[model samples]
Target chain A: MKRRSAIALVGLTLALAACDNMANQARRNPYELPYGSQENWPVMPLATAVARDEPLKPPSPPPVTMALLERGRQRFDINCSPCHGRLGEGDGMIVQRGFPRPPSYNIDRLRNVPSQHFYDVITHGYGIMYSYADRVEPTDRWAVAAYIRALQASASASLADVPPDKQKALQ
Target chain B: MAIFTPRANLFMNAALIGAVLLGACLLLAIRVVPVIGYNTQERFAPEQPIPFSHKHHVSGLGLDCRYCHTKVETSSSAGMPSTAICMTCHSQVWRNAAMLAPDRQSLAENIPLRWNRVYTLPDYVFFDHSIHIAKGVGCTECHGPIGDMDLTWKARTLYMSWCLSCHRDPAPHLRPRDQVTTPDWRRTPSTPSGEALMADYHVHTENLSDCGVCHR
Candidate 1:
């Protein structure tokens, strides 16, 4: 009986040792310094200078390509369509739900504004609109800005602007 | 001088031994069976504050998972939508419905709605939503027919052994990046086979089951 008890103890010890014990595990306390804090990351000193000194325009509108427009459409649908409406008519679902309605891109004021103004608004935010710099990368912001210009153009385009071949189809 | 014979004493001893063995079996069954049974349909189905049907939104209206859980690809948490998100549609459509009273109250009071979480892992298990999504694991593999659920329940038995089963062999569970949110998506002839996907996603099986993979 004593021998049996000794063997049982040995088995139990081995079993316990094999089990995963919570020891020496990394502990993240609530007050601990967070990973990827802004202060720890590399800073671009020129960003502020660029924002202040640069004219509110890209030298010219980006070369209009179908691929770029498609990418812009996708990005605009995800980020901008929530508040700006899918067609940029300032009647998004959020606006219908009583959030402040932004001016339509088709309006004279927005239509006349330089492309750089739109880029600035997207990067730094304008009035009630929050900055999307964190959510939208710089290239994507340009893409969205280009898409907004396309939307404005579409809203005001006349039948005369349609190609002769496409005009027949429209009729 | 004893009242009973040696034979009777032996019979009594045998009966006592049988009783002890039966008692031990009963104790073992009571302890082990319940733990296994707890992961089944009856035990893990928790009630929520509001009966928000995923079926209505996903299957009926054709809303994407990202429409509500917007941060699933970007953040660790697949974020719960705020009252404003719900109100964007609800305010126009079901403006006076009794079911949306809590939502309206939350909006009026300027307080966030407290949603009961389903599919929560223990604090010790470090799971990242972005990594799983980026690695090509579809939502349905773990979440299970979320588009069909009326009141969502814990679909999988989120036990460590169940997780390790996938970690050991995750190839069969992966799909194309575009179809990761598509609940009913399957391996079509046009799509690459599971082995090719495993190579494409670079899902190396080595060190996946290491204790620190989840525990740390």
Candidate 2:
């Protein structure tokens, strides 16, 4: 009888311990779809669909502050640098690995393009490149355009263009 | 005929001693057993389809975590690289490697490759990658030295106590927001003090460990 009672106690504890019902609940993961469910496959919004979160107003592209540039650099490095290269020379790692080269930002054509053009291309991709509207937000798209302009200027910048205090570092 | 035999007294003593030893062992096991590597699943590499190595991709090639996990900044979950992201490089290099056969098949079939979650939190726990990242919690804070891991494994037990320990005193775990995704990031001399970073990130300790913070 003692042995039976001990076994019963063990069974009770095991049963109680095994109930992770509260922890698991009924939550479905964002990406995971359960079998037998009628959930549609997750897909990026088509070009015809609402792509840009906000209207691109020419009057107010967020003032190009240092913060904007910094954000641009970060977002550009993550999203564009793989294909566009760090310096925007179109020789990124992906290109080296055989993805078609994107136009160099230093090129006259790209340099002449307005920030609005850059913002538009990113919103709805250009040429072989797919739309980055999914990854980069609207404001960040402007930031990247501004950074691209900075990259273009740096390509033609001379030693004298550097600020005197910082010139020694470049030397 | 005696009320109690001397031999019975010895047996009683032995039984008492045995019971005390057994109780001590049970107490020790209760404390130690659950935290063992086997029970915790710490450092155990679950089998993956492609045997993708973080060491090869992260350390060897210097790929950023955001290279694939693009939604990490804005979303609760760090997005897994789609098959297209893998094929971006694989289509050019290693075009027909047997290891990447599943990757190609996944793309062709339009089915996502199922990756086993290394640090699956209980559904009740509201862990947001974006919040942790925005608040400057480095990946290595919980993920360990990912660059050195050939096959990713559970670095630490995702036990509630483990989560609360850091949530209670997060200064040590805080880093620069830029370095949040850097694996095995170490503090340099130039790095801000943990307290300074905590202040900069506007982290408040009071609500961090509240049960509602994680358990929703």
Fraction of the reference Cα-Cα interface contacts (below 8 Å) that each candidate reproduces: 0.03, 0.54
* Candidate number achieving the greatest DockQ relative to the actual structure: 2
| Per-model CA lDDT versus the true structure | 0.76, 0.84
| Backbone clashes in model 1, listed as residue pairs | A56-A116
Indicate the worst ten consecutive residues by lDDT in candidate 2 chain B: B84-93
Model 1 lDDT tens row, B1-216: 988987998899899999999998898787666457464442254776568999887776555677677768877777787676686567666789898899999889776666666765665778878889988899999889888888887788777878999999888888887788887787888988777888888888998889998875
Candidate 1 C-alpha lDDT tens digits along A1-171: 999999999999999998664632354422222342525222325545654444574445568788778878867876677668899998876677566888899988988888778878877887767666545556667788889989988888899999988998877
Query: What is the Å distance of residue B73 in model 1 from its true position?
Result: 0.9
Q: What would the TM-scores of all predictions be? A: 0.62, 0.83
lDDT of 2 by residue, A1-171 (tens): 999999999999999998776656677777755533656655446767853445654335889988989989988887888778899999887788677788888777887777899999987887767667666778888899888888888899999999999999988
Model 2's alpha-carbon lDDT is 0.84
Candidate 1 wrongly placed segments (more than 4 Å): A1-171, B1-44
Q: lDDT at A121 for candidate 2?
A: 92
